[model samples]
Target: MNRIELATLIFDRLVSEKEKLKTEFQNSDSGIGYFFLDDLLPNDIALQIHDAFPKTEQMVLKKSLREDKYVAAQMNLYNPLLEEIIYAFQDKRIVEVIGEICNIENPIPDDNLYAGGISMMGKKQFLNPHLDNSHDKDRNLWRVLNLLYYVTPNWEETNGGNLELWPNGLKNKQITIHSKFNRLAVMETHNNALHSVSPVTYNGYRRCVSNYYFSKSPLNDSDRFHVTSFRGRPENKLSDLILQLDTFLRMTLRKIFKKGIKENPHVYKKEKP
Candidate 1:
């Protein structure tokens, strides 16, 4: 089957296993929830999406304070079938199903796709541990969940580029989530769901399709506003101190300026009046 056929099949399966996947995600102790649909799409189909992806450029490469890695081209890039898959998740039925599993009500996706895009981690690229921005670009809705669809073929554990969840913080340890090909990992993103991507060691790249779902109200009352904060790994003490100061300085500016130095241009550019 092709990309369309494969995506349709996976969508159907997710709908079918909605209840079970929800239970597993909710019951997990790490304050994170995810499930894998193996061979979700054939290798050829997944590769096609990879091949169809446009080239890397300035507009998409989102660099971190550490300057090691960054996310690229987010807003449902121009591929026909990929766009279809993205919007399909927006269907009322599909949204409700995901909301049910997540135990949230009436979830709405962000109109401005912030921090959702294809992430490319090249050799030596690294993403410091951080919590995603608490709200969407406009601060209208609370960021409730993150949806990541990885399509990097033959990506292995040794490759060193994996999603790490630091539920307990850097002192305790982290749960490394593999960025396996054709695997979809959906997790709740909040103040406590601290996470990051380990540095990429391989010569090739690890590419992923990212999307996020937000709601009018936060999943928990304790949720509060924050930026995509970051910190170095446990071993990188000096890097950790610098990153901490970086977050503090930026956050302080936001506290006084209310909107920061300027509106972040990383989001989709809306038409001017």
Candidate 2:
């Protein structure tokens, strides 16, 4: 029907399957933690979401990949139902349960939505492997978890546009999490958790709903202050060097200007009705 109904339906399904999903994540051998539910929502509903998403004009890129690897729409559209569904996940009870799956205790999401929004990628677009920024708007809270819901139908693995986790760093092999339809993949975000979206090779588009959960405490003590760090793939040594320098320069700038050289414009800006 609408975004709310679809989100609610998906939430109900996920809640109903919570125990199993939790167990799957807990038992996984991959330190690159995740849980996925198939056939999460009806095809029609998924199509509606893909169709209804707003333009990508307000989207921001932390690095070159967001521009080269992604062409996405942000979901700040006002819909009480969608908010309630998001709240269902935002609620402490749900967040705590998910936190338990990720082996974290008592987690809370920063009310301010930042780089959190929707994402879409078309052919030739690809997000290079990178770690999310450690903090939110004011740098007061640490982003601890990433909630990604893929809604693109029949998105094939061969087509690319999947999430990749490099828990062991870019030198080693990465764990690729397919951007499957109706799959909700939640992973821990931190300084060590290097991740990215594989390039979309096919002609079609891949769409996803993305949100991040933040907490007062850093995911780990070693997670020192840093900006969103990015790197080239294992094979791209030159790109890696460039990205490292890019991160260092940005972090250096942040040291000079605490809030950032300029405000990030990716956030949802509301206008009076």
lDDT of each: 0.73, 0.72
lDDT of 2 at 176: 84
- Output the TM-score of candidate 2: 0.85
> Worst 10-residue stretch by lDDT in candidate 2?
66-75
Worst 10 residues of 1 by lDDT: 69-78
Which regions of candidate 1 are displaced past 4 Å? 1-8, 74-78, 270-273
Error of 1 at 242 (Å): 1.3
Report residue 167 deviation for candidate 1 (angstroms): 0.9
Would you give me the overall lDDT of model 1? 0.73
